[model samples]
Target: MIGLVLAAGAGRRLRPHTDTLPKALVPVDGDLSVLDLTLRNFSEIGLTEAAVVVGYRKEAVYARKDELQAAYGLKLTLIDNDRAEEWNNAYSLWCARDVLKQGAVLANGDTVHPVSVERTLLDSRGGGRRIILALDTAKRLADEEMKVIAADGRGVRQITKLMDPAAATGEYIGVTLIEPEAAEALADALKATFERDPDLYYEDGYQELVDRGFRIDVAPIGDVPWVEIDNHDDLARGREIACLY
Candidate 1:
């Protein structure tokens, strides 16, 4: 039951700031970076072993690994994603494939969500195929966010990333509670997507598995404190969320 933090994105939208530091190292509310906050939140839920995948400005992510290890008694592992500049979050997951076991919680390096995210994953009992955090995109309709089209009746059917605005349904909050077998299945598809088009995102893997009839449980974090810090606006949003700091 280890936690994996996917932080290998180039974060081009973050520009000069990202040029100097990884998004996980980006300061959230002075003295605390988003990565630190995320780990602290993990600690609250009793997750002390967190593996962070680093890419853009990888050194910055490594610098925190030691601090996090000493300060929290958490064993932080930094996996250098050599191809991070050429791949997507899915690729980052692929790099950590050797580490993630069954019943693991995976979050993005830039995701700043409530402490409850940890509780949600830990307490779920792993009864379903995959449990993921969903959010209402109705409020903020048009970001390049991964949106899911979830069908309410019978069971949940999620269609993620509608290129057309009218087709998108809900937003994916980048928090995942996954079964190792399912992850391996998804990773296989992801490898194909990356091999064909290395630049494509990991969501493409979901599209493949969903086509094969995999049903993922939707844990809607509707109106809860969650922010994916891809740019300046998100950083501001992170600042606004009630921090445990």
Candidate 2:
């Protein structure tokens, strides 16, 4: 399966330190940065190819391509999103349209998790074009975290960033497997959303899928040690979870 590493973000939450460096290059664990450890984990999980979507400070990320390749001996694809500032995660996903295949592993560069996720997705044997790993919000969720209300049995669901304070349910772990058809449909949905509302976030695309009756399955990511490194506080927590390696 192909891997899509989403490194395209201005990292507005991570200031000062990120003013000069990309968030993906920031140190997470003892020695390895978020990008470094993330790739290592994917390599171990039987990944054949990887595409890193770089945007802000992409030069820094592009410069290290050779080093990472030499270290892992893996073929890596780098896609740039010059307009990352105007859009959200959905735009980044759109930037890699040329690189995305039939079944692609979608990962957020700012977050890190165990690579066993490959096996988890494989076990589900999804029939849809896109399926996301649904983390248990009960485990722990924040106001800024993305959440979903999945349908019964099938992974199909309506996903969104928290809209209500009291309706907390499931969290969205960044790991996702998007089938080519799903990716295309997602691109279409995003295009429509943007045409109407230029300020729309990528989450809108997922909601569109549900509206159109696309069976976007939700695979349970229960109890998996995953962390979204938004700042220094998250960095420490990520290290603790990284120790699971």
Candidate 3:
């Protein structure tokens, strides 16, 4: 299995810092960047190889690839998303489809969380579940959060940022375990999603899979503090929680 990171977005909300570096390279704690923490988490979880999808000032990542590899003791593969500045992450994730044959544990590069999040997805991977999403059922939902809804006693029914907060059971924490059995189907779904609308998110791909009768269940991260760094405020929150890891 491999570790995958979606680090392509421009993150315009984070200026100055993002002007020269990708959001993944933005420092959240001291001199350690978001990508640093992600690679560390993957290393701790026994993922020796990780594929990072890069775009938007990707040279920064290329420059530090060797240094990062040496620090984490993990092999790194850089996947370029040429359309990252024009499209959403569905296309970015689809670019790494060919490498996920052995199954993959994928996470957003901008999200700051403890290594426990990765451990939870890894520990819950059996029982024939092809895909398991790390969900934060304890977080209070807002309109911007990527929300999820369960089906009639089944797995995920839908995942979207447009869903009503009251109807959402939880926020999909941007971490997922994808068994090899579901990689191809997920790739196809991501393809269809991007072809339909380049602006759609990778979560839309999960919704497509759910609509196709695939079981994408959730692993609840109970009371585990995590923050998706999107702006100045989120960066502050990330700094506060990152030390706990």
Candidates ranked, most accurate by TM-score first: 3, 2, 1
**Predicted candidate 2 versus true structure: per-residue lDDT over 190-235, tens digit per residue:** 6777666656656677777678877777667657777888877887
Residues 209-242, model 3: lDDT tens digits: 9999989999888888889999989988999988
State candidate 2's TM-score. 0.90
True lDDT of residue 16, candidate 3: 78
Candidate models: Cα lDDT each: 0.71, 0.73, 0.91
For 20-88, candidate 1 gives per-residue lDDT tens digits of: 887787777776777777787777778768888888888777766778877766788888888988777
RMSD of each: 2.4, 2.1, 1.0
Clashes of each: 0, 4, 0
Q: What TM-score, over all chains together, does every model reach?
A: 0.88, 0.90, 0.98
**Best model per lDDT:** 3
Candidate 2 Cα misplacement greater than 4 A, ranges: 127-130, 165-168
